[model samples]
Target: MTKIIDGKAVAKKVNDQTAEAVTELVAQGVQPGIAVIIVGEDPASQIYVRNKNRKALKLGMHSVVRQLPVTTTQEELLAIIAEYNADRSIHGILVQSPLPKQINEPLITRAIDPKKDVDGFHPENVGKLITNYPGHYPVANTPRGIMTMLKEYNVELAGKTAVVIGRSTIVGKPMAALLTNANATVTLAHSRTRHLKAVAKTADILVVATGITHLINGADIKPGATVIDVGMDRDENGKLTGDVDFDSAQDVAGLITPVPGGVGPMTIATLMQTTVELAKWSDAK
Candidate 1:
């Protein structure tokens, strides 16, 4: 029988710890604040930011959302970021992705104060993650959440074979770094990789995040492997699906995370959890 990794349960545990941290910080005369900036009316982005805001407030952390028009200029966006950068009350800041074409997303990421980059997309944070920085640093939320899930489930990493399918900066690249840092031999694979299934079969742990619906199935999975699907793609029938075929893959995997209930919840959980930590780190200095 496949052991289903309960991401929601793990996320609740993480959020509970964060709530306590928030309470402690408040007692210390500091309320952790997260400023979420969003541009345009992207329905998906709006929902994501709203969820983050709601969770932050539920955990008793200070939360703010700044909604900008789609036509907002680069200079205008930078000015708002500058305001947050200088504001001592704002402990962490996140700019939702898929910004309007006129705005440069990477430029905005660089403009944020590294200390307050909750999204962990800042070059400084990415560099820190790649180099295995000795001190505290934020990581991209999804990957961070995935790692938390892995730990909570006690999935062995040291000397294990882990294959991460996809190479996006946000999830794939950072995920491989984390697994490797944990002493797993990591293989980062993508669309161009030849004999992809053969490479996948070699993994004791497999993570798929290619944004392709049902891109992987049981045949691609090693029997008794741990499968983590990071995709939230929609199938032809307009139903939410993951990169891996859950029905078939689950039968083959020793442990597997489901589509909606899996890695999705962990992303926001890590965000709020890391926000609390950032506040502590900032206040400690």
Candidate 2:
């Protein structure tokens, strides 16, 4: 049987490290603060924000949540973000995604100060990622989480064939950039790609983020491959699962990350780590 990657356990390890960093920052007379703004009452977004807030508080960090009505205007939202941007206590700012129909998400993202764009969604951060310079922008948490897992597992990416199955800006594109930065030969595949399975089977490392549960199986993976499932899907019965068929892929792969205990927890942990890092940077100045 393939070794299962315990993301929950690993996330704890990451958080432990981040807790120490937070302590150090607090000792320097600076408290790390994260502001999360949700435009509408999206159930999933609310759940995510709640979990993040609880985790932040647990680690002695300041957690702020801003909830706006569904009918709130773009100007009103921007005004709120500007307040956080100017607030010296707030070190990291993340506006929960999928803003209401009337609001412009891109404009709001751009309005966030580059130093405080912890989600790495702003154009400034995006450009830094495309140019292979992570220092120029804040790195997205999901990609950073994946990289953190790989490092903890002692997985070497240099010259390895890494395939990312998605194209979304949040996960797919950023993941590919991160893998390439690690010296991996990366391929970004999408739905329209011809011979998808054949291409998928060529990778030493495979990351699925299509959000389609069980879309990939053993036939699409190489023997002894390392599979990273970045999907969170609900079945007809509302059971959460991932993009890859864990049972079948585990039989063929050397290592695999499960659905619930895999990538999800790590994303939040990475976000907290980034917040602490940003706070430390501010304190140093």
Candidate 3:
């Protein structure tokens, strides 16, 4: 039987553990605090921020969301970030992406204190990640969650051939670094990669994150390979689907993640967990 990876169940376990950690912090006279800043009223961004805030509160942490207008000036945003950065109460700070064109994304990312950058887009964290050394720098949440899933499933990466499809800095680049750091031979495939299917079929562990719906199917997978699909797209009939065709790939995969119930929940769960970690790190200093 193909073992189906249940992300919701895994997310629950992660959140439960985080709740325990939060309790310990509270007992130590500290409450984990996170500030989520969203530049505009993007429906998807609003939904994500609400979920994160709710989860943080449920875990007994302080959660604040700063909703800024789309026309908010760059100086206005930076000043707000500076306020959060200096506030000892806020241990983690995340700025929702897709900022307005007038605002420089990199400039804003660099403005936040690296220690409180829970989103892990800051160059300091990115450099630490690329070094592949042992450190406490935070990483992209989706990749961090996927790595947690691999460990929970007892999937060995040492000496394994791992292939990651997509080269987005948010997920793909960090994911490849993590697997490589764990001793896997990692290959990152992008849109321009030649013989993509042939490259994909050679992996013992395969992760597909290309936004295209149904980009990979059973034929692209090696028999008994572990597959993780990170794409959340809508098919022609408006049904939710992942990058890999689950219906066919499930037959060939040893273990696989589903569209709605797989990697999605883990992302938010990781955000909660990392927020708690940042709180602990701050307390230590």
Candidate 4:
């Protein structure tokens, strides 16, 4: 029988830890706060922001959301970001992705104060991650959460062969870096890779994040390999799906995470955790 990786359960554990951290900080008279900025009304981004706010508030953190109109100019957005940067009480700031076309996305990301850039998209933070800088390096939410889950499960990485399918900065590249740092032999495959099937079969751990629905089937996974599916796609029937065909891959995979209840919940939980960390770090100053 294939072991189903319970991402929901793991995320709940993270949430509980975050809540406890919040309580501890509050007892010390430090209230962690997160500022979430959303430009335009993209439905997916709206849903993500709403969930983040709800979870942050539930964990006793201050959740502030700044909603800007689609017509808002670049200067207006930068001014708002500057305000958040100077606000001593705001520990973390996240400008949701897919900003209006008029806005320069990279410029907005760089404008965030490095210490408060909880999303880890700023050049300073990215540089730290790239260089494996000493101290606690702030990683992107999803990658951090995925690492947390792996640790909680006691999965060994040393001397292991791992394959990551995706090259996106947000998940794939970071994931490969993390795995390699743990002494694992990491192979990163992308859409352009030749003999993809042969490449995927050579792994003790396989992560699928290609974004295309059902891009991976049972044959793509080596038997008894642990699989992590990071892509979230909606099928024509409006059901949430992942890059891997879960039903088929399960027969071969030793462990797997489900679509909706898996990595999805962990992302925000990790974000909240990062927010709390930022608050504590800032409070020490």
Q: Which digits, one per residue and each the tens of the lDDT, describe model 2 over residues 34-73?
A: 9999988999999998999999999999999998899999
> Model 3 over residues 1-285: C-alpha lDDT tens digits?
789999999999999999999999999988999999999888978998898899899989999999999999999999999999999899999999889888999999999999999988898898899897476878989999999999999999999999999998789999999999899999999999999999999999999999989899999999999999999999999988999999999999999999999999999999989989998988443
| Candidate 3 lDDT score relative to the true structure | 0.93
Say which candidate scores most in TM-score. Answer: 1
CA RMSD per model (angstroms):
1.0, 1.3, 1.1, 1.2
What are the per-residue Cα lDDT tens digits for candidate 4 across 1-285?
788888889889888988999999989888899999999999999998999999999999988999999998999999999999999878999999888899999999889988999998788887777678888646788878888877876778899999999998788888888888888899999989999888988988888888889988899888988888898999989899999899999999988888977788888889999999998888443
- Relative to the true structure, candidate 3 reaches a TM of 0.97
Q: Which ten residues in a row have the lowest lDDT in candidate 3?
A: 276-285
- Candidate 3 at 56: error in angstroms? 1.0
* Ranking of predictions according to lDDT: 1, 3, 2, 4
Q: Taking the tens digit of each residue's C-alpha lDDT, what string does model 1 give over 1-285?
A: 899999899999999999999999999988999999999999999999999999999999999999999999999999999999988888999999889999988999999999999989899999999999999989999999999999988999999999999999899999999999999999999999999989999999999999988888999999999999999999889888899999999999999999899999999999999999999999543
- Where is model 4 more than 4 Å wrong at Cα? 283-285
lDDT of 3 at 109: 91
Best by lDDT: 1
Residue 88 CA displacement from its true place in model 4, Å: 1.1
In candidate 3, position 31 carries an lDDT of 92
Higher-scoring candidate on TM-score, 3 or 4:
3
Report the poorest 10 consecutive residues by lDDT, candidate 2.
Answer: 276-285
TM-score of 2: 0.97
Q: After superposition, how far is residue 104 of candidate 4 from its true place, in Å?
A: 1.2
